[model samples]
Target chain A: MELAAERHGDMLLVRVAEPRIDAAIAIQFKEAMRELVADGAPRVVLDLAPVGFLDSSGLGAVVAVRKSIGPDRRLELAALTPAVARVFRLTRMDSIFTIHPATPGPEPTANRQAAPAAEASLPDGADEA
Target chain B: MKPEPVLAKRPAGAPRHPPDDPAAAGRAGAAGRGHGTTALQASRAPALQAPHCPDAGGRVPQTCSGTLRITLPATETGVRRGLAQVFAALRQGVLAGAVARDAAQGQAGAAEPVPQVPQSACDRIELVLAEALNNIVEHAFGPEPPAPATESRGVTAPGLIALDLSAGAAQLHCTIRDAGRPMPDGQAPAGRPQDIDAAADLPEGGFGWFLIRRLTLDLCYVREPGCNRLSFVIPLSAEDPPRPHGL
Candidate 1:
């Protein structure tokens, strides 16, 4: 998996380029997030659009990232593919994080308290399969 | 001295194997015709006999619900081969049990129900087992063989690597042990060491241990005098307790 990060306003957007995030890479996922949070970014958005699969380990790493952001800071997950979304449902973590459905339009605007997402169209190059 | 076969006559539809067949030793591909049925019959004994362990420390942990051990040479290839064999057996056993239970609960022509842990879990099992076995190959095998290993050789000392599998009512347990030096301080030999403060954006090593920790409910590492042992357990079911109380 490849993780790329950039600063946008007070929020740091970390994009992971990978096919799956599970036990195979959970450790690296945690480590990469820890590195991103070390800068003390008040908000972080994790783009998992590239992820094709997510398991319990992947979920735990995301939770750890949320905790790392601290209560004062904000953490959000974006561009979750349907397959990845199923994992969130399986573990019921969908209720815990801000999951912006991968919409066909531009990236969803950042909101400190992310508004609840409604089913939306898919972005280009993002196949439902 | 010839002894009566512990296995009873094969049942109809059960695969048949000669009493001395090594292929039927492990629960992999060997079709025992009605081996599942035979195993069901065997399981009825309920002698409370736990799986065997070759080493004293190989004893099942108090938290473990059940345990089994398989022996293979302590070589790179041997460790890999042994892991594949044992893991397949465990998965097959669980799959067979689920199938038998569903069939027994229903009549013929009924749909064969699927297992909770589907075949997809096979990949996850491989990932988890590989991490545990890697420790044995690297740390347990020690620095390097005093002499180069060759494929044709047989029965030579290949150091000491043992695969121990235990299952709690709610969890699946795997332990790998080797007679090697104690783990270095904060520096694991085989994979990345535990790091709590590393960056989240950089692509780097040190993810395997973290994956192991996240994948398993609990992990324990022990360096007793001569052996380095690593054990990990994952909950067997989403609804079941990790292990039976007092087990």
Candidate 2:
């Protein structure tokens, strides 16, 4: 549940520093998202570049976070790794969220489902949230 | 955190493998394993009786790929480790299956199909397994286990899961057994798809069985006298590229 949030202009970009968001930590992830979104950003983009696996519990947690943030606010997903992207696609959640290309990575993979990685260029500037 | 005891040692004759031994985990040569293969014949869990397997006495056709049997405590951490070990063994199967297929075709060509488990397939398997294992770990064994050996009718006691996973070139077969409570009506639930159209109050919990049903084939559930058994086969394809969207 190590989520680092950065304000990219009007949007908030939260990078999931964890490789997995499974049943083991789905609650923590939802709680962390709740706290991050407390800043009242209109749009929040979850950087899922590092998450290689996401189970049903993890998927539920993401949905729970969205509901907790209120319907007016948008919770977009960015740079879902191959595995995470597949989970979203299989569960049909991909259709629900507004997905965007990842920031950038040193060397990107050929998997067309996911965008490139982002941790390589994190501006660890103080947490605006 | 108290020291976990080696409470139930499986019978020496069981074909089970230690999850700690990664290299030895895959080669579960259960070809000649006699009648008891289907049942959890272990003396561990003294109160629980032996679970019955349908193919108990019948000769199991030889599975050329890796076969791994793991007896894991029904807990989140235990299921996580079990999934990891099974995933690793599956990778081994994929590699072996690919090489066997390649050599059988009489082509000593360069590495073709990425030589690893398909990314798309791995994701599905991981998600389905995570859902199933987490379901069993959390619900099947009831609430947090009562103090170790105290077994009452309320299901306050946690149980163990014996998992048999085999990865072949064509399909991956899994058989899971536990001493916990059986499915409510002696059958697995029909996990229906959630209506995402419900803008705000979408369901979160019931999606697991839907994913399991969506991803698996030949799914079957049975409640033996003292145990619950579930077996399913997930077909695989080496050359299946990722689908653009859900089917």
Candidate 3:
């Protein structure tokens, strides 16, 4: 699993370069994300446009990464391919994360501005235990 | 570690047919013909058999079902390879079905091309098969062996996974048999995906079976003797094309 991580202010944009995110690469994906966000970022956006297929194990790995980021930081998903998005929808994981239509780009302010109102409405520390 | 190959048989009462011999179609009785026409047969009878249509050169053009049967050790790489081969066979079967359908309508030599299984259906089958295969590779064979232990639980024991896929006009049927540990309570899990609270720790697992159940019809599982058999039917419909994005 190849992932390219770019830093935009306090947000990290990680793009999966693989067409598949199945059981074979699920663990590798989680480990890569953990390493990329080791220092922790205020927000992380996983760009899954290149991923044409995502199975349950891959979905779990994404969730595991989100939890590993802890409560202070948030993990969002962006640019999901139809097939990957379908998995998220079928599993109802879409409701749990802030999803963007496309990559928010280099400008962190643009992302904050484009963030959905529902995401903005989240209570402070709501994700914290 | 490679597990040994375990012989697998079709679930009790499932219609038995020769493996990939087009000539055997004539041997199948009328009842088998009905069973092979549509996935509806699976719903009506647990032992639904497949149709044994005549050869392509025969006078009557019928929807001839194709079957691919293979047994492999319960290893990750082996499962992956097996799935690839099975999917290829399924694609060929679908194409053959389309040709048979066209021939039945006297459109075999027409200028217009015969319709094939939609990309959506193929994608769904691939997804579902991946999940199923993964489950067998991970759980069925039991846990990995200790560092010094050369053989894993299933690797040393009678650990093998056999897959049989039958492709027809209305649906694709897959039968998976494994000589490994049975499901907890000897029954398939019926749990649905649980609601997640974002404020708490997000769930990292438990979605495999739910996806399988949602994507398939007439799903059934049986634990018989020393093996477990799981079979499911995936209906092919043009209306439900896979969306590339969003809900």
Q: Quantify all predictions' global Cα lDDT against the true fold.
A: 0.49, 0.60, 0.60
Q: Which pairs clash inside model 3?
A: A82-B244, A82-B245, B25-B52
Ranking of all candidate structures by their TM-score, best first? 2, 3, 1
- Tens-place lDDT per residue, model 3, B1-247, is 3332222223334443333432222222111111212122222112212222112222422422345455655665455445554443343342354334433465555654333555445557767887887787788776552222232333223555666666556577778877678888887777477557655767788888877887787888988667778899875653333322331
After superposition, candidate 2 runs with Cα above 4 Å error: A104-129, B1-65, B92-116, B145-158, B238-247
- The residue-by-residue lDDT of candidate 3 on A15-82, one tens digit each, is 77776777767898999999998867789989765565688989999999988988889999986654
TM-score of chain A of each: 0.77, 0.79, 0.81
For model 2, what is the alpha-carbon lDDT of residue B128?
Answer: 74
What is the i-RMS of every prediction?
11.7, 9.8, 11.1
**Which candidate should be chosen as best, given TM-score against the real structure?**
2
Worst 10 residues of 2 chain A by lDDT: A120-129
Which lDDT tens digits does candidate 1 get at residues B111-155? Answer: 544334422233344445655554455555654623323212211
Estimated TM-score per prediction? Answer: 0.41, 0.70, 0.68
Expressed as tens digits, the lDDT of each residue in A1-129 for candidate 1 is 478777877878787766556544667889888987788888788877655445445666887778777778878888765445544543335556676664222354542112222133122222111
Q: How should the candidates be ordered by DockQ, best one leading?
A: 2, 3, 1
Candidate 3 regions exceeding 4 Å error are A106-129, B1-65, B91-95, B98-113, B145-157, B238-247
